[model samples]
Target: METDSPTIPKRTLADLLFILFLRLVAVSCFWFGLQYWAMLVGYSLVGAGRFDLLSLPWKVASTSLAVLFPVASLGLWLTVSWGPVIWVLAAGGQVLMYGLLPDIFGPNKLIILLHLMVAAVYCIFRLLLWLEKRRHRRQVSVDLP
Candidate 1:
């Protein structure tokens, strides 16, 4: 039976670097998740009398994201399609939260912008590889009799 799925093109150096970037992002996602979780736990256990999100809606919203990011990290590590979607969502949520409630969540606007810039750079590199591959394919087709 003919397969509906097309064969994947051979991996190149650029593809490998892209995969490495994804893996690095995955690891960073895991770290960020853990960092948020640790803060929640620390607030609850150590700083209970001083401050915590327990009294605010941020508690629930941030808690939800604290759970989401690491799970997304797994998909990112595997380089699945859903990974980027979830990662972007988590990152956006963090940025919005921190931007609006800087007192509670410590991340500054600059940090979030920097994170996005890094992703933008990765995307630009990936686009160049894709365009190069397409150009090569067109040249090969044109040369064939």
Candidate 2:
């Protein structure tokens, strides 16, 4: 009964959506990484040797995120287990710090708002995925005997 063709694992709609979500996450990570890099380089060039280049806490946080972004991007792109962990560390740090001290980030409210929007959308996606799984399970159970 064996055929020459290899079998592919069946993927449910949730799996497909998850893969798409991961891809989008990786893309956003890369985008933010670039933004961080640009800000650092631009500031460094504009104010070389300046002691107050960035406030000490902001400097430390931004540097940490700048370093973590590439590794996270690769991890996310590959769907590695730690990829999301790294992304959360970076993004969460920014969100937490900005929430604690909005002035340090900027006068503009857009950054904080964008972060909240992304978090909200992610929560919604997770909810949808859970509902999909629950519905599928119920259908399968109903069909059996």
Backbone clash count for every predicted candidate, in the order shown: 0, 0
Q: On residues 1-145, what C-alpha lDDT tens digit does candidate 2 reach at each position? A: 5543335435667777777877887887888777677677764446442334777876787778777877788897898879878877877777767776767665435656776776677678778878987886798689989
TM-score of 2: 0.69
TM-scores, one per candidate: 0.77, 0.69
lDDT of 1 by residue, 32-138 (tens): 78766876777434655222636565676658778888987998899898888888888878777777767776658785886688579668876988897998699
> Residue 84, candidate 2: how far off, in angstroms?
3.2
RMSD of 2: 4.1
Model 2 ranges off by over 4 Å: 1-9, 12-14, 41-52
Best candidate per lDDT, number? 1
Candidate 2 achieves a global lDDT of: 0.73
Worst 10 residues of 1 by lDDT: 44-53
Clash list (residue pairs), candidate 2: none
Q: What's the C-alpha lDDT at position 30 in model 1? A: 95
lDDT of 1: 0.76
